[model samples]
Target: MRCEEIRELLVAHADGELDDVERERVDSHLANCPACRRERAAFESTGNLLSLLGPVPGAGRSISARVMATVRGEDPWCGHIRRELTAFVDGELTEAEARPVREHLATCAACAAESRALERTGDALRAWKLPSMRIGLARLFAPPRARGRLLRFAAALAAACLLLAVGIAFFVSESGTATPPPGLLRAMEMLDPATLEILDQDPGLLEIVRDLELLESVTDEEVALLTLNGSGG
Candidate 1:
């Protein structure tokens, strides 16, 4: 290929878009011609500079709008600001991250109204009085180790209660054929044969129940430790 042909294909060569035969011809010409080689280098340098300029402005917002339009059947421009409104309201974003969002909200009435709505929702949540639960429901979602420990503690308590019921039944039976107390008979009836078998198989459970207070104290301390670690993280 001549220098003119090679120069015309330099951009394609720099981008690796030329066919193998065309690329080979260009390479052969470029190696022999200083001017063509310089042209190829310049094309590559220009490409690098263009890449540093980043994506076109509003390109991300345009794509986000299209996606929101498809998924939500709403206007596209609102999608970008709507997604960030919660973070803006919560003061979760740094100033650099929040500036464009703030500017958009200022100019876009719909987005500004949505931001106000989010603020109101947050205020309502903070003001609401939730009912207190004796049991911490948060424990249900604790890390696996914590959850396992809680399950074991619960099992020990349950086994202890079952063992107490069994002891009461024995006491009633041993009372020289006297009629059992009212609830004692009912409790004995509720103690199924399967449960009695489980207790019989796992005698270690009785030991756990005996140290239930210590186990409970240890669990509380560990839970407190875990809460501190999570907050620190």
Candidate 2:
């Protein structure tokens, strides 16, 4: 993980909000970059300071008030921190939530340049950041593919949950409802009177289980004998 990216994630990581893989990346980065580590510590300290504020004041400021005040009729700031894009840049937009910003940035030159400036600032900070950690041999040889792995893992978990839910619903609906395979039912129907008698006369025939591969090589007589023996039982 790059130092700048780690700075973005450090707050969430320290707060125990990051997934295991993300946590690992932060830990790995922290081991190498002391500056980023300090930034992370500073972020944690900020979080603690914010927590002391106790449930950050809500979106108390009316959007219409400032919009009307400036005659712009647009809320340049909606929630906290007093500026729209600044609040967004402070790690508010998630993977899904960032899509709108991305679309806007693509079309709006002013916003895009502002975003670039923010990124440059973050990059400069990372250049000076040092790792407060030592990387062990085991941690150096690691792969970096969190987004896909998380997606696949989530998909598998969802599939397993769906299967479990289906199983529960099926068993709930079908308790005491037992049915044989169609092939077995047909074979049972095929047991005519004479065949049943022949089978009944011989109980020791064990070739009723047709899956016995060796029985494929058995003589016709033996097959007949086994079939009859099975029916008799």
Candidate 3:
């Protein structure tokens, strides 16, 4: 059998719910496939965990009632009934409610996947640990008026940092000369004619600007070639 077909049977096989023929097929496949064996082992281990929780109180009647309701042609997919799946996983459902959920999960692949995902999430949350924290320690406890001023100062600093970061990013995209500081590039963009003339006195600065203009005029195809060839132009 294909891996997927074998997988669909793994859970049922682990639960001993498969018919003899299907069980033999799964057993043959598992004997040869280490991955499927691992999967079966994992499911069996999770089943053991579930067994430890024992039976949920008051779940039998609820499961029977839900099954009866479903038999009466009530929509099992309705929101209220569907929401019970979560409660069912949490052991909040009585046996009656839990039974239908378990049967539904066994038959419906999507609901079964969701129930496993919920179970994994619950396991993770249960295993998670929070580090101990000291209360009100390492705090300045600034007065409200002072805190307001601090917030305004932080806002202004953040704005300034944002602008500086943007300027640097634009400079990189523009391929500003490494010889000149990024601030110099920004200054040159907004400089008066006299300031630009002074900058032009530097041969290296003038050469970079000339190359930038040539790049701006290059055709798309030429740019593609340049990119492919790693050409300076």
Candidate 4:
């Protein structure tokens, strides 16, 4: 094999990946060619170095510990003191609690700078003037137009509920109940004299009423057609 071809196989040869025939060819070339022998030697040295430096089981954890230690900054004591600096600035900490933070700030330039920033922030907040707010319940009352809409909505809702109750009674009767259900009796008792008189005058209205399921299944187009026919009549 040519030196170039032999060099290509050198890495695989060093790794013992080459078959016996390919290894013999490469070995014959290396024995005669000093340049190829040097190339093979370089590959072998690199493999040996890589084997020596191959991953130790917990080397990753050791490296991570070092990286974290570097990232946490120069002072290990600053972490706890930095947390309490806010409380220290607010005068919320006792002298015992504040002493360590004070001593830390005095020695550590980074912590001292943070403490100064906290003090400035506290001072700015204390100096800030908030606009006075007038407490009034009058705004909670609805406007006249809104009140009218609300009243109309409430009346329409009440009427819908009454119609639903009457519909349920009609549905029960249609199912061949000779006497009204106890639920219907209670509903009738709750009705005013005027409503009872209206129902008495037009008992057939209840009989003509469709089931709620049928009424709900009705489409807007069907309602429009019904309205048009009613107007024509």
Best candidate according to lDDT: 1
Model 1, residue 204: C-alpha shift (Å): 33
For model 3, residues 119-166, the per-residue Cα lDDT tens digits are 654443333221210111112123444423322222222232334334
**What tens digits encode model 2's per-residue C-alpha lDDT throughout 145-230?**
43333223222222322333334334434652222233432343244445444443433324223321222333466445435534
Rank by lDDT, highest first: 1, 4, 3, 2
Model 3 error, position 53 (Å): 64
Better of 2 and 4 by TM-score: 4
| Candidate 4 Cα outliers beyond 4 Å, as residue runs | 1-8, 11-74, 132-233
Shift in Å, residue 76, candidate 4: 2.8
| Clash pairs (backbone) in predicted model 1 | none
Cα-based lDDT for every prediction:
0.59, 0.49, 0.53, 0.56
RMSD of 4: 27.5
lDDT of 2: 0.49
lDDT of 2 at 205: 29
Q: Can you write out model 1's per-residue Cα lDDT over 72-91, one digit (the tens) per residue?
A: 52556568768877889999
Instruction: Give the per-residue lDDT digits (tens) of candidate 4, residues 121-158.
Output: 44433332212101111221235453333222222223
Q: What TM-score, over all chains together, does every model reach?
A: 0.30, 0.23, 0.26, 0.34
Sorted on TM-score, highest at the top, how do the candidates line up?
Answer: 4, 1, 3, 2
**How badly does each model clash, as a count of residue pairs?**
0, 11, 12, 0
lDDT over C-alpha atoms for residue 219 of model 4: 46
